[model samples]
Target: MLTFSFLLVIFLLTILLAVFDMMILDFSIWEALINLYFPEVATGRSFVYTGVFFGFVICIVGDFRLYKKKKLKKNHAERDGSP
Candidate 1:
């Protein structure tokens, strides 16, 4: 329940950030992530773009959260296995 709410907030914020990036910066985070892995996708002034930055921020936050959850679960399982 708590994790679900946290994830929901994160997803909503990401959506808002993406919309802001598109409206203000004029680009899609999805497009930028593709361009990040494949530079040939979206070129020219790419370094100054917002999509890649937003994608990076969103991915990092999400990864950090999932890592925390995974670690917690693994520790729980280890303790359960111990005794």
Candidate 2:
């Protein structure tokens, strides 16, 4: 759960940074995202975008695991009849 929370925070921070870049740097978020995932040529921006994407994937996986764990616990509690 801690890892999930930490990754979620990082993912959110990266999104905030991307928004800042879009507003202040006047760059297209769509372009950065497309190039990052489907790169024809390597650029420094691609690296940052990659980190953002990787963080997003990690957060999603972590959240899924946490959800499954919580669901399993709920099922067990219900089965045991311990309200």
Candidate 3:
């Protein structure tokens, strides 16, 4: 259940970033973000890509942090012989 929640968060963040880029930069709503990495792409596209990438990366890091915390709690509980 926690994992599903985290996945939903990441997905929502990705969509929000994409929509922000579209509204603020006039970028194509359906444009493939991967294309922004190419040197041939416009500078605006590069910026949009960077923003989206960072947004998703932050979500992934958060998910990892949550997983670590959950594991640590589980281990502590086991040591205490509870549940």
On lDDT, the leading prediction is 2
Better of 2 and 3 by lDDT: 2
Q: Per-residue alpha-carbon lDDT of model 1 for 15-83, expressed as tens digits?
A: 776666667766788864444345655566567556656766676777789889999999999999995
lDDT of 2 at 10: 70
Q: What tens digits encode model 3's per-residue C-alpha lDDT throughout 1-83?
A: 44566568867876787777777777785662433334364757767768867866777778889889999999998999964
Between which residue pairs do clashes occur in model 2?
none
Instruction: Show where candidate 3 strays beyond 4 Å.
Output: 1-43
Candidate 1 accuracy as lDDT:
0.68
Q: Count the backbone clashes (under 3 Å) in each candidate.
A: 0, 0, 0
lDDT of each: 0.68, 0.73, 0.70
* Candidate 1: regions farther than 4 A off: 1-48
The local lDDT score (0 to 100) that residue 3 gets in candidate 3 is 50
lDDT of 2 by residue, 1-83 (tens): 65567767877876776677678767698765554346687657767878867877787787889899999999998999964
